[model samples]
Target chain A: MSQEKSLLNKLVFSLQCLPGVGRKSAQRMAYHLLDKDREGALRLANDLKSAMDEIGNCERCRDYTEASLCEICRNEKRNEQTLCVVESPADVAAIESTGSYTGKYFVLMGNLSPLDGIGPDEIGLNQLKTLVEQTDCQEIIVATSATVEGEATAHFISTIVQGVKDKQVSVSRLAQGVPIGGELEYLDSSTLALSLANRQSI
Target chain B: MSQEKSLLNKLVFSLQCLPGVGRKSAQRMAYHLLDKDREGALRLANDLKSAMDEIGNCERCRDYTEASLCEICRNEKRNEQTLCVVESPADVAAIESTGSYTGKYFVLMGNLSPLDGIGPDEIGLNQLKTLVEQTDCQEIIVATSATVEGEATAHFISTIVQGVKDKQVSVSRLAQGVPIGGELEYLDSSTLALSLANRQSI
Candidate 1:
């Protein structure tokens, strides 16, 4: 009985490792799994173990994959000449869901945060530079987020890619302005200002 | 690559079986686990598997346990003459946290919801009746929730226990009124009325 209680407590404690899960939620989740969805909990355990053990970073784009190349990198019809750089594999998924960008991606895994000691080399920027120099890539789309660190990383990448001696690479960034469907009264001042400054003629 | 993606997808899908987790949260959990906390994730997997496989209901109380009897049931210090009947193990925990209940518990696992096909027998009321008849228990405390189903279950248990012949068992319920620290103005009409009707002398 003591061992069983300890195991239950351990399960609850370990469940808190997930992002956004707290002690209360973890206890609720543990009891829920034990009571209602034991099968799903077991399946989740197996999947978590296997995913953690097998999934590795993609050799080319540094995105998560089991193989040397991710599915997008291996696709033949994708525009290899254009590389859209983003902060993480989640960004890759977000862009893929849009179905608008047909180009390849470069996942940095994180942005440049020098205070936290995350620099160019830490985010695999060297691998990105090598990929750009070795391939026939023509355009680099800086698709990092609009946060301060994201902008800094994008600027750094643009400078490095444009510094390539033998090839000319055009660098651009995703547009920053008020989001579609955002009301003018509710939008933040900076976003509204950016939208006004870069207003389109449409 | 396909197999790995399927595994990752399975992880995300299985995570959604948790209460309050949706597709977006599941995706975030999966990515966060794979990226930041592989050790914690693996430990969680092991804990989840073992907890699911080994944990079973306590034979006496019908509460979750690994052995035939739970810790509370095995303890000799508790008041065997008083048994607290609750709807779930969570209720037991809540009451135990108060440190006021020293009696053994009878977990119904669920309430009597006849429309959902859950009757007295479904909630182990027969076991509770047997326990009362065969033991020297003098009091039965119904600690079910304050909801409609909880009240119905409590009433059903009280009626069934009162019908038991050759034994005198005093049945009681947890008080219903204004919660501790609750303001009268903010409380609902029914709660305020209950508090007024059950007013105690200071």
Candidate 2:
């Protein structure tokens, strides 16, 4: 009985590791799985085990994949000359879903936060530089988030990639402006300011 | 590579089985597990598998346990004469946390929802009847939610328990009113009306 209680406790405790899951959410998840969806819970367990054990960072772009190079990095049809740099694999998926960009990606996996000891090296800036120097990558599009760390990471990447000796790689950032469908009144002051300052004439 | 991608996809899909987790949240959780917390993910997987495989409903109260009787049911110190009937194991936990309730519990697993084909039998009302008849239980506290189905279930339980021949068992319900720390302006009319109608003398 005590053993069973511990197992239940452990399940709830382990579920808290997921992003945004607190103790209450964890308990709910555990109870929900046990009570309603044991089959799905089992499948989730198997998938989690296999994914965690097998999936590794892509050698080239640092995106998650079992292979040395991710599918994007290995694809021949993608624009190898244009590399979009972002913080994480979720960002990679977000961009891929747009179906517009045909370029490859360099996933930093995290942005620079020096207070948390996340330096340029920590975010694979060295590998990104190496990729730029070794490949025919002509343009680097900085797609980091608009946050302070994201902006800093983008600036650092631009400096490092441009500093690559004898390389003519052009560096650009994703435009910061009012989001599409955003009401002027509801938009934050900083976003509104950026939109006004970087206004483009039709 | 395709196999790995499928595994990742499966993980994300399985994570959606969790309550309140949608496609976006599931994807985020999968990426988070794969990227930031592999060790935690592995532990969660193991714990999930074990919990799902081993945890079974308590035979007496229908609460989750690997044992035939849950810890609460097996405890000798609890007042067996008074059974607090609740809709789910979560409710049992909630009441237990209050530290006021010292009686045993009868977990209904679900309330009476006739529209969804959930009748008394579906919620183990027959089992509850048998429990009340066989045990030395004197009071059955209906601690189901304040929803329509919960009220109907409470009414049904009260009628059935009262109908039992040769034995007398009192049935009661948790009071409904304005919640503690609730303000008059923010509270709904029904709640305010209930608080007013059930007003106690100071």
Candidate 3:
């Protein structure tokens, strides 16, 4: 509503760069920063800058880290031979929060999109190749999403790992089906089919 | 997963300060910033810092501004004598977007919440009273939200204005009823009652 090129406008516009934030939310955020939590806003700004300046792709797994290798990659306790490959660093965090997997991760940064011109080389797949070869990994868990692009990426990686002439490394994808506690009636046919095809014994 | 004091962790924690952002969303935002739109994230950080450093309460209306007086208050074309009293700067933005009112605004910054110890002084109600008296405003449109605290604040302001012995100032609240395109069945009973009570003939 304000036609002027004020700092408030700039703040609102900048806030909209966040994934889901729209104009109204951006305005609310701007007002919130000015009104109640200036200290928090300033901290967020400082943190953003610091993170931008310091955080970069981990040399081993492509996860965001200040150091050359991420903590996961550097930890001696983690099973280096069992790498869980994920589409993004957020996926790595998601998998970590489960507290189940003790293996390290390889973040692809994004799934392969052919139409979008993103291929193996574009998203550090060559680096991933070098990583697979250099390390004596026994298994590669494909934790990419269940979407078409995610499946394509997983399949491509699976083919590459299978073709490794010198060594054999088993590749597996995350289970696909209806979610836990989900009703069969509400689930789509594709999920139901996947669930049926990959049915487990009780 | 990387329990160290990493920049990604710092970024995620800082992002959680934004409204409606939880751990997952914060993580996602952190990853998004690092993965795709580093430039945009940096811009947002810069904007946040600059806006925080420059923008402060307007001298007249308590709305955010780079200058002493906000643009609306500074505009000679706007009717200063007709004031729109609202709960926050966001409310001011909402009203301004309507383009119906040519009046100035007085932002309360917050509604009166006696339970939380937010009183007249906390919301700058005394300042509002002084502004009303000094400006000799003909009308005050209480455009606060349709909530208990908003109504209480509106009522408090209405009483103060009516009791002013020096000059006659009219105080009015925004109409509460069904929205313009809302269906009758879906309308809340309180709103329906209000609409029926305030019904007018075409």
Candidate 4:
């Protein structure tokens, strides 16, 4: 009985490594894996191992890829001149799913957090700077996030782009305002103020 | 990009098999497996496969086991004369975790859901009957559930026990009332009424 309990506990503990999963959820997942969908769990495990082993940062954009370069970075049709810089691979996926962006991406993998010891080198800001300097991209889109750290990272990146000699590169950010289909009544005061301040001409 | 997207989609779809995990959660899980806890994911997969292959119904009880008999059934210290009947392996696990019951158990694996084509044979009621008749158990605790179906199954089992010629076996159920520390205001009318009707004398 104790041995089986230990086994269950171990499985539950392992499941807790996932984002947002608490003890209850983990236990439920463990029981489910043991009882019902063991095959699915096995497949997921195999995928995780293979993905971890094979997927590396793309040579150009630093996104996850099984090869030297990601499919997006290798594609000649995508606008290399218009690069969107994001905080992580998940962000890259988010943008791609929207189907609105046809340009390339540069994944920082993390944001700059001095307190957490995540600095320029740690987040691959140096690599981004080098890429900006070398590439023929005339525009750099700093789409990090909306938080203070995100704004700070964007400012740092813009400064880097401005310092590059000879080539003229324009840096921009994602607009902060009311989201599409967002109701005014439900919006926070700060966001409402920002939306009013940055009001667009219809 | 499409190929990579499909791979991610496959992983996401697989993750959706977990209870309470929707598309958004599945995607998040997939990314977490890829970006952070690949090793954990791999281990989970291995455990899933091994558990599926090895775990089976215990001969004495229908609860999940790696051997012919579950640990609880094999344990000589437990009360063999008292058998608790439950609807699922999870129910057995729940009772075991409580550390209160030291008796044997018979897991039905499911309740009698006639609409879903589940009947006596489907839930191994015949097997349960045989075990009850054959064993020297003085008491049979029907702890299936508190639902309508659960009550019906318990009634059916009681009828079967009455039909047995020799030794008299006592049938019992889990008490239904306002849970410990439950507020009267929060409890449903039916439960509150039940608690009142079945009140214990101080």
Kindly report, for each predicted structure in the order presented, the TM-score of its chain A compared with the true chain A: 0.97, 0.93, 0.94, 0.93
lDDT of 3 by residue, A10-70 (tens): 8888898898989988887777777778888999999999988888778888887888888
TM-score of each: 0.97, 0.91, 0.91, 0.94
- Candidate 2 is graded, for docking, as medium
B-chain TM-score, every candidate? 0.97, 0.95, 0.95, 0.95
Indicate whether candidate 1 or candidate 4 has the larger DockQ. 1
Q: What share of the true interface contacts does candidate 3 keep?
A: 0.69
Model 3, docking class: medium
Give the poorly placed runs of model 1, Cα more than 4 Å off. A1-4, B1-4
Q: Backbone clash tally for model 3?
A: 0
lDDT of 1 by residue, A149-178 (tens): 999999999989988889999999999887
DockQ for candidate 1? 0.65
In candidate 4, list every pair of residues with a backbone clash.
Answer: none
lDDT of 3 by residue, B96-180 (tens): 8788999999998888998999999988888888888788699999988888888888999999887776899998889877899
Sorted on TM-score, best first, the list reads: 1, 4, 2, 3
TM-score of chain B of 3: 0.95
Off by over 4 Å in 3: A3-5, A175-179, A199-202
Query: What DockQ does each candidate score versus the true complex, computed on alpha carbons?
Result: 0.65, 0.60, 0.64, 0.52
Model 2 lDDT tens row, B1-202: 2344777888889999999999989998998778779999999999999889888889999988878888898889999999999999888888988999889999999988899999999999999999999999999999988988889999999999999889989888998888888889999999889889999999
